[model samples]
Every structure is written in C-alpha cells, then in structure tokens.
Target: MKYNRLLCAGIAVSLLWVSPCPILSNEQNTSYASPAPAKGRAYYEERGDIVWEVPTHRKLIALTFDDGPDVSNTPAILDLLRKYDAKATFFVVGSRVEKLPHLVKREREEGHEIGNHTFLHSSFQHISRNKALSELDQGQASIVQATGAGTHLFRPPGGSYNDSLVKLAKEKGLKIILWSWHQDTLDWRKPGVHRIANKVLRNARNGDIVLMHDFVHHSTQTVEALKIILPELKKRGYSFVTVSELLSNREKPDGLIEVNK
Candidate 1:
C-alpha cells in the first residue's frame, strides 16, 4: 500500500489513481505538527494533538458528517457516497444511533466510518466533569452495541470544544476530530446547495477535513451539495477518505474496529 507524504518530507511520492467515481490517491500521507508531538498528559493537554487535519502534501481529504444515522437523510447521503465511491466518517449521536441501529450498521457495512458525537450532543467543554464523561461513556456504549465496534474518533457537538474536553476525550481513548474553517460546508444552516458546494471547494487543500451534518434539521442540501462537491473535488485532484484512513496513512478497514459483538 502506498502512503502520502508532506510537502517538506523527503519521501518519494507514488501517485496511483483508482478509477471509479471519486479517484483514490496512493500518495503517502504524514503529519508535521506545528508545535511538534510530545509525551505525557501535558503534551496532549494542548489542542493540537486533538487533530483537526491530517497535515499531508497529498491531495486527500476526509469528509465527516455529524449527528446522524437518520432513516431518511442518512440513506440518501450514503447513496451519494456510493455513487461517488467515496468514504466518510459519521459522528453519530448515541440515542439517534440506538433508534437507527440498522442505519448505523449500514454505515459500517458500506465502509463509512462511525464516530462518537456524544449521547445527547451536549457541550462537553462546558458541562460538568462527570456529566461530560458520562456523555462519552454512554455514546461509546451505544455505538459499540449498535455497530459492534469501538470508535476512537470523536467530535464535540456544535464544534464547541476546548483543552478540557480534550482531556476528557483522551480519558475515553478517543481522538478529537475538528473541522478546518476553510472546508466547513455550513450545510447545517440549510445553506443553498450551490453555496455549500462553493464553500467546500473554494479553499480546499490536502489533508483537509470537510464538515457536513447528515441530520442537521435535514440532509437534502447536504446530499445535493455532495452530488456536485464529490465529483468536483475529484476533478480538482482530491481523494475522499475516512478520518482514520487519513490519519493512519492507510486504507480503511474492511469493517469497523469490531469488539466482542
């Protein structure tokens, strides 16, 4: 398997394009932290290690949708993803996942990633310590029970996170996944399809994590934007991947990280 490389890295990049709807890149992917990786809890105590982007030179991006597994919209979004042969990460709410276990399982079967978005979609950064931890615990349980896998990726609700939330997230063994401002589609606001598509492609770059919501009010606009966005990004030389695939610099697993199912 070929990996992606960063701009400053000395590794020779091998470009292999997988033909289909969206193209897949075989270039090596690596991260060069601005402040650098460190040891001890004090190290991850900062926000950088929480991982907002992959920091690679290869033209690869991860599409992450939050608060989903909805009966109506999730299937539509999944259809769009299938149409483009693209993979994405879904940060799902626990209760929603419980109510839509089949949808959650479908996401796993279809090769999309599932992440913990909290049981109640509460503000982990602002909630009380126990409450915040409880949210993560419950969310993890629901996901594992529903999909028979554990997610190491988590995204705070509404993107309202802080260093404290980082600590709690690490306690749960989850790596925080945030969105870059440049790639935020803002489809949650029901932005017009054209506007959402334009925003994502405007300043898109390598190692970007474009944020969209599958069930934010509804997913019609998001699904429509994807019809345009996926192929357009592919045309502009971008490959879609899951968050873990982007971070780990490898292909996504055949299924999720299954636990004792």
Candidate 2:
C-alpha cells in the first residue's frame, strides 16, 4: 500500500512519545485537535501504500478482519467470536459480498459491524476514477441490500488510498477507516498459530485496532491468538469494541477503523 511517507514517519515518531495515558498539555492539545483524513492522498494515488492509521490513548481495542465472506473460514471466525461473546468489524469486499450475501447478512445480524472493503478487493489508487467509484458503489449497495445495513465506513483494499479518493468517498457520506496496530501475522504465509498469538499479546494496547485475516489458512492462528489476547486484555482492564465504538465518543464524525485483518 502506498502511504504518505511523512505521515508514516510522523506516526512512528508520535508513537514513541505516546504511552498509555499522558494527558496532553494545553499547547500539545491544540496540535492534535482535528481528525485526520483517515486514509491520506497516498492511499488513492499509489496502489501499494496504506494511507493512514489511527492512534489514541483510550483503553479500548478494535478487532477487524478483511478480504472475505469466504464461506468456510468466515463462519468459523464468526463462530469463535460468538463463543467469546465479542463483536468486531469486518471489511467486506464488494464482489465477495455479492457471492455470499447471506454471510454478509449474518455479520450484521450477529451484531458485528461491517465496513466497505471496495468491490473486488482491488486497489482504489490504481483504478480509474469511474472504476473506483463503481467499486465503492457496488460494494456499498451489496452490503445494504444484503443486510439492510448502512455502511458509511470504507477501508481501501491493501489500505491504498489518495486525496481524490477520500474526497469522493466523503462526498458520498462515507468515512475512511484504518488501523493503528498490526499483529503482523502474515497469516497468508502460513505462520504458526502460537507465534501469531504471541505477537498480538506483546504489541496490543489500549485503543488499538488489530489487523488480522479471515480468508487465509494460517488465519486460524489469529483466532488462536485472539483466544489468549482477549482474555489477557480483559485481565489488564482493556475492553474490546468495534472500531467505530472505540474511536468515536457519542459525538464526533471520526472513529477507529479495523482493516486488513
């Protein structure tokens, strides 16, 4: 994903100074007041860059999954989540949602939140404006048709996005969502389950949006990790919530979004 280099660097540096809860001074407060464009220009301009990721100080975490409605795998993940009595955000591809509208409905019916991952899971940056809009439109329509759900949130495939794209989405009344923490499971690479679990446990924190997968085989590892990670977080007094619930208070147009899970 193409990311804004300056934005990426800024986040890394910012993360270094930000701990659990260091109340910002009055001057520091003014600087971070505005909500950023969730996905930056680079996300839509470059096909391989992730535009933006959220950073916060609250003790809440957003768990998200992407690229699926893969019948076999997605249901299992949902089942596991149900067992834990947890809810999360699923960024569903437009085409995939069409193929498995029932699954999409289940996601919403089950009390899980759904967001647009675009139609066909393609790069919003590389495609033409017309095609990009079509992808977004199709996905949005499919999700609504399938679940009677209104999704104003979008997560670009591969997290690639650009300025024009953000504007387009916003004009359509959608908010771009991205993640702050990555478990780095690379589940598609078939990493071990235990290892993936450990990575999340070690890196997760309050207000973290953890990225994991549902389509890949090794994603089972992510499920396994969640088993341990969720309990541990609970022990530490951290609560799990959908990306929107954690990022935004009762008021505010911005919220944390889970992506590329």
Candidate with maximal TM-score: 1
C-alpha RMSD values across all candidates = 18.5, 15.2
TM-score of 1: 0.76
lDDT of each: 0.77, 0.70
Q: Tell me how many clashing residue pairs each candidate has.
A: 6, 16
- List, residue by residue over 174-217, the lDDT tens digit for candidate 1: 88787876888888899799999899888798878999989967
- What TM-score number comes out for model 2? 0.71
Model 1 Cα shift for residue 182 (angstroms): 0.7
Q: Report the lDDT of model 1 for residue 44.
A: 48
Q: Name the 10 consecutive residues with the lowest summed lDDT in model 1.
A: 27-36
